[model samples]
Target: MSSGGFHVHGPHDHAVEHAAQGHGHGDDHAASHGSEGGGSSMSKIAMFTAIVATVGAIFAYMGGATQANAGLLKNDAAIKKTEASNQWNYFQSKSTKQSLAELARDLAPEDRKAAYQAKVDRYESEKNEIKVAAEKLEADSHKFDRQSEEQMHQHHRWAQATTALQVAIALAAIALLTKKKWLEYGMYGVAGIGIAVGALATLHI
Candidate 1:
């Protein structure tokens, strides 16, 4: 307080002040490192989530396509079945006409008998042709039914894969929050299963 009319700190006070500043700097450095570490972990989790989301979207699209195909095949099968039934009805109508024609031939005069017989023969031929067409339509309907069932199975597999991927994404979020390595590993395992199922669906298994 002498020459410049200012108060001066002693050596001990200066030392104490320097120690306090050192402690503050140490705390700041540690806080910075912690923040950096947390940010890195969050980035890693975000990257993994992005990958899962991309894959899940692909699987969901595939599932929708398969389901639509199945519906189309089912509709085709229904159409074919209706066509086959119509053909069978036509055959039955021809049978009824043939029966009436045969009865008329038996009851007709000798001069008209040949005409009625010709009508009966024509009806028989038409009935045979209708039977063939109806059988073919039934076969086609069965084929369509089988195809629809196969597509539905593929759709189910895709659905399962998509669900598994969603669960994995949720688990990954939990792992990020809790910082648990085991949870992270479990997420990877579920994601692997989802991928495997998706591959199976692609192969139509």
Candidate 2:
């Protein structure tokens, strides 16, 4: 029937084709593995970005609080210094007036006595004014100190909060990188502790 012995694709050839098709499924599995690897990389980057932002926010808050606290402290010191200066001025003026009155009393004639009395009256008036000014200064200084102290306490709280936030962000980042469930929960727990501390401090203040 055939001109010579020759090979032809028949049922056996079809079986070989089926084997090739089954082997090709490996390529699909490999592609799926590649896709999963890419997804992992993307997820890692997202986690990193979130962690960095949280930490950055904490640092920013800390910086602001530091500046506020320093300014308040400086203000308190300045007010105290000014109050001291006012007190010194008042004391000096009173002492000078007293010395002058004593001198006038010691060396006075009848006509000069009237003039000396007038001088004493003027000095007394000036002394009263000085006393009033000193009292006002003292009051203002105390007010300034109280306000500054409050501001300092507020800033301190802000700093503490920022520090706590930073710690939480760092822990979260580590947990995500490591894919550890315990670490993730631990981060939240630590953050809660910080909040409690802040609350207590606020209550005390």
Candidate 3:
């Protein structure tokens, strides 16, 4: 014991020191546990984000495939339409030539065999005309087929672009889960570029 409102203890005061040490150790342990929990939460967030991004990428690929198939179908339809038109034109031209030949033969009767022979020659000439027209139309149809194939190819490119956009968007969303502002920002930039590409591709379609 001491004067001036101060007290001094012997060996028992060591108990106070011991209690303080235990409290401090408890506090440190609690703090460590909390820190570990926070780290685990962050890891979970990263894992979730990754899963979402992967799933989105898969869906985007599927969508791209479907869109490409649709474009191919459209091209096929266009080609068929053009082919049908050409066939109709060829039939009409052939019929017209045959009808004209019959009319010319009916107009003459005195020299019947000579007239018939002339009609045969005219029919042969008309056949040549039909053949030439059919050949030209065939060539035109082939050209159209090539154009349709090109169009389909353009559509496939568009699909790939859109798919990339979808994957980028998903990855951006995942970045947000980490609460890393910089990562999120980078993802946003990637997503924007993907969207621009998709838009350009769609325009071509």
Which predicted model would earn the best TM-score?
1
Cα-based lDDT for every prediction? 0.96, 0.69, 0.63
Q: Output candidate 1 Cα RMSD.
A: 4.4
- When summed lDDT is taken over every stretch of 10 residues in candidate 1, the lowest stretch is 1-10
Give the C-alpha lDDT of model 2: 0.69
Residues 29-114 of candidate 3: C-alpha lDDT, one tens digit per residue: 99999899767756654565565466546545645665566666556656655665676576677667667767766776767647
On residues 15-97, what C-alpha lDDT tens digit does candidate 1 reach at each position? Answer: 99999999999999999998998888778878989999999999999999999999999999999999999999999999999
Per-candidate TM-score against the hidden true structure: 0.81, 0.62, 0.45
Model 3 lowest lDDT segment of ten: 51-60
lDDT preference between candidates 2 and 3, better one: 2
The clash tally of candidate 1 reads 0
lDDT of 1 at 130: 100
What would the per-residue lDDT of candidate 2 be over residues 141-160, giving only the tens digit for each residue?
A: 77776666766666666567
Better of 1 and 3 by lDDT: 1
As a TM-score, model 1 comes out at: 0.81
Ranking by TM-score: 1, 2, 3
Over 4 Å off, model 2: 1-59, 62-66, 69-73, 76-80, 83-87, 194-205
